[model samples]
Structures are given as C-alpha cells and as structure tokens.
Target chain A: MILVIGGAASGKLDYVKSLGYSDSSISDGFIGEEPVVYNLQALVAKDPEKAPGYYDELVGKEIVICDEVGSGIIPATREMRDAREATGRLCNRLAISADSVIRLVSGIPVKIK
Target chain B: MDFLLTGGAACGKSTYAEKLVLGFPKPRFYVAAMRPYGEESFIRIKRHRKMRAEKGFETIEKQTDVDEIELPPHSTVLLECICNLVDNVMFDDQGNMYDVTDRIISEVLTLKSRAENLIVVTNDVGSEYSDYSAGVKAYVQAIGDINIALAQSFENVYELVCGIPVVLKGELR
Candidate 1:
C-alpha cells in the first residue's frame, strides 16, 4: 500500500497511473460521495481472507494509492468533522498497513515511508 | 453539522481547509483523497506528503467507503475532496449507484452527527462548461447535485476563487 499526499492539482492520480494500474482501477474521481470506505470494501471483497491484508496485496501485485489530507484546519460543523475523522482513520489504518509512503508537492515526489 | 467547501479546480479549497486545521490547538488528522494514477501524479502526491510530514502532520489515506473506520471524537478531520470519493464509489459497482449514493450520504451525515468538527472539500464542477460527453455530463451533474445537498446540510459553506475564500453561507467564527 502506498500513501500519496498532496493538495489539489498535485498530480497524485497521474503518479499512481504511471505505476501501471489501469485508469479504471486506480482512478479516484468520486464526484459527490465518500469513496474511501467503499473502495476499501471492494478490495476486501476481492479476497475475503486477505481483505484485511491490503498491504499484502500491494506487495507485488499492485500499488494501492491513497491521498494525504492533513494540511488544513478543523471545520466548525459536526458533519464535516465526522467526514474528516472517518477519512483520517481510514488513511491511518492504510498507512499502518502500507509498505511505503509518499508525499507530493507541486508535482514533485518525496518518499516518507 | 456538515461544512461544505466547494469551488472550481485549482481554486484552493484544499488550501483553505488546511489553513483552518492549522488554527486548531488540538491534533488534526488530514484525510487525503488523491491517488497516483500515473508517474507524474505519483511524484506530485509524494512531494505533498513529504511537506506535510515535515510539518509534523499525521495523515490517513483513504480512497472509498468511510463507514468502517474508527475516528477520534476529540480530533478534527479534514476531508480533502469529495469528487474522488464519489468516483471511487460509482466505479466500484456501476449498478449500485442508488445504494452507493445513499450509503455515502448516510455515512457522511452520521459522521457529522457524531463528530466534534468536520470540514469537507469538494469541487464546484457545475459552474463550468456543460457540453461534455453524455456520461461525463451525467457524472458532473450528479456531483453538482451532491454538492448542493451537502451545502444545504452544512452550516458553513465557502467558494474559493484565486485562492480567496468567499463565504457563501454561515459564519466561520
């Protein structure tokens, strides 16, 4: 699993695609909904026994790309907070399971794991 | 309550949210929705993460589905972008659009109903050109509708232009 971090137009998606994953497989254009949970579940459904082993899947078969979103402030509203919390927790879980982590800046790549 | 920050591409919605997080005294978790789909994007994501890590910011990377995770009530969360989240959900299972949308909305609402504070980032794709492919048009429309609904639910809504935050609804203070 690879945790990719960057702001808008940071080219995170393009980086993942360069690693050789199909556009459909590695794309993250969820228009109006929360996608991390569903994407994780889809990965789990692929292999129930290895569902929790997201890291294992990334070892050789493919690179799991995740967005980094911790550069901002907390929203004053409750719902916004919840979404942030949920997204943070999911990223943390994946990071813990990931073999490597990377951060992007102005289209630049830096290894952090 | 839900707080929706929507704007055009490169409008600085993510940056504004980041600024907000920096103001909080407590530890804040940044939820990133970006993925490296190609070599160019890969480098970009890596560089950004490096910058945040240097600043001592702890991050979480999630692509889709948020209901199964465990979150801290005391910590504030910033959901970088809803557009990617929606794409992940829609692509997961094309036939399950209704179920996926409903589930996402419910989960988002649930998060707001339980968290101390939440900030959501999304794109205002509706204000741009609308004469793309049919599928693309539908996708844009769906996202537009979702953004509107999110704004309705959120108490604080802002639209960014040239990196400036124009308050659309509710006061931040």
Candidate 2:
C-alpha cells in the first residue's frame, strides 16, 4: 500500500483523485469502523507469531493514504505521544512494503521511494 | 493526525504537495495512484512525474487491493489522487456497488489510523454540475460522504481554489 504525506492545501487529495481514485479509496478516516486499524494494532500487540493471520491478511494492498503528523514538534500529552508512536510505527511498516512513495508540497508531487 | 487537501480540478494541488514534501529534511515516499490505463493516462502520469523532479521523489504505481497492505513507521506517505483509486477498485470486478463502496471506505480509514504522516490528494467534486449518469451520480454522492468523514477525522484540512490554499482547520503556516 502507498502512503501520502503533505501539509494543508498541498493538493495531496487532488493528486490522488486525478489518478482516478474516488474519495472513499484514499482517506483513512471513513464513516464507520475500519479493519486494517484493528488488525495492525492487534498484530503489534500480539506479535507476528501470535497474529500470523493478521500479518498475512495485509499483503499487497494498493495505495494506503495516511495523514502526516511529523510536520511540527512532538505532542506534550501522553495520549498524543502514544498516538504519534502508533502512527510512526504504522507508516514505517507500510513504507517498507510499498513499492514506491511520494511527497507533495504546494500542490506539486515529488516521488520518493 | 491526518492531513486532507481538497480542491477543484487543475487548481495546482499536486504542485503544492510537492513543495511541502521537498521541505522535509529527510527523504519520503511518493505514492501515485494513477494507473495509466491508456495513452492519455500514461502521458499525464509522465508529465506529473517530470514536474516533480525538483522534490526528488520516487514514484510507485499502485494497482491492486489496498486493504491488504502494510505501512512502516516514521516515514512520510503521500497519496496522489483519491478519485481514481475508487474508480479502479469499484469497477474491478462484477461486484456489487455497495460492496465496493464499503470496502473502499474501510480501507481508507484503516490507512489513516495506521500511518505516520498521511497526505491525501482529492478533488472537490461536490461543487461541480449535477447532471450526470446514474452511476456517476452515485459515485459523486459516495465520494462526498467520504470526504466529509475524512475532513472530520483529520486535524488539518485545507481547501484549494485558484492554486491557493485556504486553511479550514489546524495551523498550516
């Protein structure tokens, strides 16, 4: 899966849509429950050996879009830190599996694998 | 938190995203959702990649199910274009439209919750003319709902008009 990162108004969504994707396929925050979120965390909590099924379940999905939280300094609250840590781990894992990666700025796309 | 960028077509969303990514101190991943199914698509993808040279991005072409992929931590993820990805997946097989929509939404939310810095690119389809095919209408409605959900979930949301960003939430400057 691929992840997208950019600042506000950077055209990240437009670029994805231009590639023929609808809004549903790009954002990670849908109206209802999402399977990947639960599965990934479960796997991390239980370890790969205990959650082999979860590990096998997430192979070869296309272009997973994630919002970037690294643009500024770290959060002060513990809950925020935990959220950031989870997000950081998730992005790192997806990046390694992704065939390529892209970054955007001022509505322009930059390819970084 | 998630970052969402929405705007009209040809409003320079891609260009803006490239600049932001370039500003990062470390290298990041650039995910291009365009498949280039025809000559026109291929040319367009080529042009986009070429224009992004200044940002030093590596391009990955994705054309598969998005639900089964895994992401790494601490890395920047850029997804260029959400509309096309939905179109490709929704019609991939002779599947029911509702099923496709459900899967798409689920996958997107999953990605957002799991990724580090997820940058999303999508167009503002709600403001366009309403006269369209039945299928097109359904797609637009579905996408509108999805966009609203994304905006609500993300900490940062921006609307681009005439190549300029009008921040709707969070601190962007």
lDDT of 1 by residue, B60-85 (tens): 78776655446766666777677777
> Candidate 2's error at B13, in angstroms?
0.6
lDDT per residue, candidate 1, A11-75, as tens digits?
A: 76677656665555642422112212113323332333443344443333235444433233333
lDDT of all predictions, in order shown?
Answer: 0.57, 0.59
Tens digit of lDDT per residue, candidate 2, span A5-109? Answer: 454456777777777777555324321222222123323333323333322334355554444432223344545544544544455555556666555677788
lDDT of 2 by residue, B51-133 (tens): 77766666656654554556666556677777777777665466556535566667667777666676788766655333676
lDDT (C-alpha) at residue A57 in model 1: 39
| Strongest candidate by lDDT | 2
| DockQ (CA atoms), all models | 0.02, 0.02
Query: Candidate 2, overall lDDT?
Result: 0.59
Task: Give the TM-scores of the predictions, in the order they appear.
Answer: 0.55, 0.55
